[model samples]
Target chain A: MAYEKPLPQPTAIDAPYWEYLRQHELRLPRCQECGHIFFPPNKVYCPSCLSDRLEWVKLSGRGKVWSWVVFHQRYFSSFANDIPYVVAFIELEEGPRLMSTLVDCDQGEIRCDMPVEVVYDDITPEFTIPKFRPIR
Target chain B: MAQMTLYDFKDKVCFVGVGDTNYGALYRTKDPRRNQYTLGVEAFKAALDDAGLNKDEIDGLILVRIPSYQLFADMVGLRYLRAANTFRGEGRMSALAVQYAAMLICSGLCSTVAVVYGNDGRSVGATYGGEGEGSSPYDVLYGMTSPGAAVAHMWRRYMHEYGAREEHLAAVATSNRRHAGLNPKAVFRDPLTLETYLTSRYIAAPLRLYDYCLINDGAVALILTGAERARDLRKPPVYLTATATCTDLTFFYTVDDFFRDGVRRCAEAVFGASGLTHKDIQVCQIYDNFTPTVIFGLEGASFCKYGEGFQFVQNGRISLGGELPVNTSGGHTSESYMQGFGLHAENIRQLRGEAGDRQVPNCQVAMYICPAPICAAHIMTRR
Candidate 1:
């Protein structure tokens, strides 16, 4: 049976992140005062300096796979068909890491620190999900 | 490294007693006769009986994964408590509850404290994945929907970065199972072999069935009093040398660095206050919610280099007869998964020389580590 995985419910702290993912651009919040760039797209004060001034800076959409796991068991009914799919932790060029799935490649090809580029998956009508594909 | 102000204040308290019902096998599934409160009270009662004290003696109550503090207090016949609180979490809160009780004692707010923990996640069929409660939505949407999946990635990363293989993880599982066999109360005492571990089906590719923690119904209570008072108690006092909690909540699942900094922070404070190095620890009861977590914790506690944790476990270093034993009570994996409560209880037994077959002989200082999402640690030394 085919089913959709859970979707993100955009909160005020993270709405801009989903909005940019929908537009095929990856952006992260950077502290204007301390120059600290971070991920998960929801932040108020800088984690380093506690400054409230921040900006959503567009990323290069390139990163290295810090780590990855292949889901062999279906924790979610929606992901049953995708059993053995890979969830790769991507360390973007700008320092922050994001939890994303590997795409446009075979499962055996996933490796740590492998260079990857962001790819858009329009999994839902309202938004697009940003995943990574091994940079060929 | 900055220190939390409370770290200096923990030395006065000690864990004097640990008690639990026969979580042997009957309690793994829910029984109509018991709920969370009843189980909690049962453990609480056992602890009081073990401590040779009455319910009226406890002035502080810290409940982890239990509800109805008032009802429980009334049920346990504990009246006029100076402090009562309910804590909830994966496993971190169990050890954190110890600190909660200790801080209350340190501040002169309470004379004696009881840290009670009870869980029914298995029979209740609690999921570690999906939406709110314990999981992050980012993971719920992706296929990495469970704690096991998240930790599986951690092992994959650790292996890739440090030259570890499934064989190394097999060592961890094999050692714990061996230790569990000695523990009659352990939930799963069936012997596990490395060959079997390597062949076991994967729940999340890198994490085999052996790497996961069992979800079973159980409760563990720890009673704390002043170190001076504990020395004269029914059992040998396990002095609370130090404890610390750390969290890296900024980015995604398990946070920015797979929660390594939390473990590091906890280790610094725990070791610093004890005036003990990693070498002084005779036994280590890591919160083995998953096998890779032990790997992360070993690195955090300075037992080994960041990427060399796998190498350290090889050749029986983590086994009972080795230089340092890790999880001699089987931890959450093979032991009763009372959240992280069982790990602390096991270390206390080891320190008191009461751990029958699994005892690490000449055990003096034992370390309890809760490594992950939020890390907490305690150093308990025999007095």
Candidate 2:
């Protein structure tokens, strides 16, 4: 079936982030001057030092749940089937945090700071998104 | 570098008129004819009547929720505008509008300013989530849709950081409902209890149905003028003592600091300029778009130490007769969710000692705070 769920429309600033994800590699921009790693990959310059000299560094695909929530109400038709699904803010070991889904885990067992590792969800041939699973 | 301090505009401007559509009357009214501007006009006319001023006297206009100043100005025949602008229909703009209006008046741009807001949200089916509600395409990918979801995560982290239990969140909803019971205009006044709150379905887990605000149709308007001119108006003037705002432009529209740094800055500016501490505030109206927001607002405003807002609200602390009453008008959750517009109006009413049964006695000083990405706060006094 065609992908019915929402996909990130890559822009010029962050297109490489998605392109790398398509290859099952989790990389984010690290500022050369300030060494600040940031997520959503939308910035051309370092948010901390405003340095334009930054490079996409490979990540460990590991993080902890800084915070999380379960969706009991459906706001999007594409997400209706995933009612009660878990979405979380994963704070990567590299220090940047981003929102992604938590899969293959019991909702009742989820707790803040629980160790998690990234897993790829290739919903369509054109796109592959990173989700997380508890590091059991 | 020059040291920057807030230009003190305290007591220079005052709210002369406050008006709104009958919230209780329009709770579920689906009047297709009653659009945003029509509702705005209704509130505008009532504010003019309340101020005992003719619409022709409104030389300045600041609009919220409404799309354009030109559209509203054309409809209301306000052609003498020296200053006029419109804000995006975000709840945070309510206090900003008042602050901006005060600036205009103090700058001698216009003496009498009208800040108007109207929303046909309920009538138009405001989901407050999904594609068009201003979520990025990236956020949609993870099914992170509503504003409540972001707050839920924050609330959960608050729980982890502060050891606050579910009862703390329940207390906020129940107490607001308790206050709503005393408010004739409140929408959900039928005695909410801890049990009821606990059993409420989670719209976003960790933030239950009761945590979410009601989506309803309504409009709110307030008129402002020089404090000297306001004293001669139809009602007692509520002076704008001090106002401050801070912003966080994070990718998620939230911060791990839980908005404390920003809110604390706003608190210092508002209190420092007003010469009033939280103790001097007889009543408060913190923006409660979500119940957790109330917790964040209180902590950020220094009503309690950071991580203790959930505790500060316990044991009737935030009740109408509590040490520091908050959201005595039932706030956005039980009251009509006019975004921050209704809460701002409620604060003015409390300061005026005109809030009917929900009035805080001798409410000489009142404050309003919203601890969102754009954290804002203002202190008002009847004197």
Candidate 3:
């Protein structure tokens, strides 16, 4: 039997992000005029300055763990077996934070402000999930 | 409009009736809608009965349903009435409901109004288990299956920003459970130790089973009438001193900043209207879907300084005998989690001196601060 992985359905606003993930990069929408970076990508105008000229920019995955929790209960059945996993919000060096799971460390060992690096988990043939690991 | 003062609640509208059903884990065997309908009807009737008013007297109705299922007009038969107005949404909807009801009465649009809420997670089947059929496309795609996960994100961020630990989180659960022990209405009304909280199975990372509120089958209702009418019917009518409502663009991914500062605007507006500070409030009925939310609301409501809420709980400041006793009726943690309606009912009970064992002694002023994804707040006082 072959393992089937879940794939996130992409929309116009977030399509570029998924495309960027295919090439192993994290991309966000940056306003060409105001130089503001936005996540979960949106339409043309910059949310800050309402500028229509926005460019996609890759982010530095280096950041500190802002906060985290270890899940002992599986909210989704697909994730049941992966009990006690750590879910964290990492504040990136590029001034934006993203929510992703933390890997490569024991759940109990995870702490706030711990330096971390992004590690991609190739869960499926077409998708590689962006996760974090402690930088020691 | 000069940001209408919060003091508009003075000698305006009052809550004459309040009621709630039992709170406990609702298993899959029960129908959630039935629980909501039955409890809602009962509470509605009880409020009407308590106010010495007939159902026909109600000209406006406000309903708050979780999982965004029930509409105010549909759930309680408000549409069938020849009533003047209706409104619907989550518990925070009450703030606007009360304000609208006040305006209706003040303007001779309508007189009596009823606000109701109900839910049954144990019997009706868990609506939060999987991708909801009609959720936002963003929520469905990103595995935002339940509030537990979304709030966990905020909790993780706060923990990382501050040097707060699991122990600090443990303190919140332990204190609420201890307070729940004294209230007969609470579902998990037994003393809980910090060790028990730390070891409890995690519902979401950073949130233990104890840190999350129980999804039980229950209903709560309140009757709002002009202050003049309320003064005549009930013993010690609980006046709505102030109310405010506010909303933020809803997208967890785009709106990464989850400090709940959006809700603070509602709190400040309401508190400003009431001319009261945190100290003037003898008891506070804050919505507690998760322990961290309560902590966030405490700071947002000016009960404590920002980012210092964890320290306040650490010092036993939010307990039963603390400087400002909060959620004396066990709150969502120990009592029933009826969206945010439970907090509203508890505030009425406290202000009227009807709170039995968990009463805050000689309570005069009470505040019900609701910080749902869409926020609403109200301050109540004894008449």
Candidate 4:
């Protein structure tokens, strides 16, 4: 049986972030000058203060549901059986928001500001997708 | 800064040719680029033929999806004297093209310009389902699947924030459907009722099946030339009097106000440039991607004050023969959902007095609002 492989493309700017994902760590670049955290890490300068000094920091993997939607339509063949899935933008404790799928809870139970924690799902041998589940 | 007058570009440029292909459910074979090229070629040929000119005479080309600096010149086989790529929302692409083409013509760098747009949503195999590149990581992580889901989130917020009822939005859908019934090219011409709109299965909370624009494959094109030379063309020229665009930097969150600030700014600027106000606009081709979008635009454009847009439409003020006839060719709601391309083509028809059943009598001026979240407005007049 031929197994389908999920594709992951990483550029130089994002390689470090993806590398961290391999270790089950959520890493983002924080501007030492402005104390701002940015995702999809960039090189050299801070977008906020144009400061060159930056540091990579691991996040707490906890956040609150800022907004959410339940999609009844399947957008991908891989997700066809996963219809009526819940997608949300969670406001992390670090002040940036992350988009992820909500799992382990009924769609009716999801609400704004609901507490959630990140959970990793290993889909393929080399890949893991980040999903969120209600803390309760 | 003085208050700018609206409808001010009296002798700037004019539309010489207009063409469009059928709009319907997604095509099964064509990709987006092919759809664009086919529609571009058809509209380009028709415009050139209609003007009794050749393709080589073209000096400028403007497009939305493809960049001008890319292989567009090679692919289209025209060495443009000038070219522009507009990356804003799709609906405003053509209108902005018209504005840029006019500037090129006015600057003497180009005598003739072609503005084209096309999309084969059906044939592209995506059908609003597949994910594209560079989507926000936040959006992808949360399983934000389609535009419907995102807009539904916004719609729910708007309803909650403004106390807007579902029926208020249903009126817009039903009205567009009623108007589409008179448009021969409209895909879903069956008259829709408020009950039907309300009862339809939800794509997301507070949004019914009818609230969204059908993702159809279609293309529309227009030719822009100097207004002085417009009279010699085969088609009656529709004068491009004024155009303006405004953008809000805040992407998803900043626009949570939903009052359409960018749309209001564009409308005010265009109207100021043309020396005309919303009252002077006899016909309007407002973008209706989602029903509430129209209501938001109507209010934001100052056609009516905020909170009064629903009442204005409820009183039959936007229908044909009403105060301000809108989307007579069914707009995106009933007509083809070529993004905002259908709205522009319909505007041209109205200005030319060629709109059959839905024509507003003696329409001297038409205002087209393309709200991409980033908003643009253009005022065209009968020559």
True contacts kept of each: 0.84, 0.92, 0.52, 0.43
The TM-score, computed over Cα atoms with residue i paired to residue i, of candidate 1 is 0.93
DockQ of all predictions against the true structure, Cα-based? 0.68, 0.87, 0.44, 0.30
* lDDT (tens digit, per residue) of candidate 3 on B181-282: 887767887788877887777776667788787767777777888878877784568888877777765555223445357568878887787788877888
Q: Which segments of model 1 are wrong by more than 4 Å?
A: A1-3, B1-11, B27-30, B131-134, B253-261
Q: Estimate each model's TM-score.
A: 0.93, 0.97, 0.87, 0.81
Q: Where is the poorest 10-residue window by lDDT in model 3 chain A?
A: A1-10
lDDT tens per residue, model 1, B1-383: 66656446656888887898666664445577676787888888889888888788899998888877887788888778999988875577877788878888887899889999887776677767654445666666676667787677777877876688877888888888888898888888889987789889988888888899887778889999988777778887888888888876544544434566789898998887778888889999888888888878888878887888888888889999998899998877888788888888888889889899888887889998887777888888885
Error of 1 at B31 (Å): 1.2
For candidate 3, give the docking quality class from DockQ: acceptable
What are the TM values for chain B, all candidates?
0.94, 0.97, 0.88, 0.88
lDDT of 2 by residue, B1-383 (tens): 56544545778899999889877788845676988899999999999998999998899999998998899999999887899999988888888898899889998999999999999888888998986777877778988878888889899999999999877888788889999899887777899988888888989888899999898888999999998899899999999888999997677865798887788899899999988887899888988889988889888888889998998888999988899888998988998898898988888888888889988888899888888888898988997
Chain A TM-score across all models, in listed order? 0.94, 0.97, 0.89, 0.86
Decide which is better by lDDT, 1 or 2: 2
Better of 2 and 3 by TM-score: 2
Model 4 per-residue lDDT tens digits across residues B112-157: 8877676655555545534663445545544465556666666555
Best lDDT among the predictions, by candidate number: 2
Decide which is better by DockQ, 1 or 3: 1
- Model 3, retained fraction of real contacts? 0.52
By DockQ rank, best first, the candidates go 2, 1, 3, 4
Fnat, model 4, is 0.43
List where candidate 4 sits over 4 angstroms from the true fold: A1-11, A15-27, A39-44, A57-64, A112-136, B1-11, B22-36, B48-57, B63-89, B131-138, B165-167, B202-208, B232-236, B249-259, B304-317, B321-323
In angstroms, the error of model 1 at B293 is 2.1
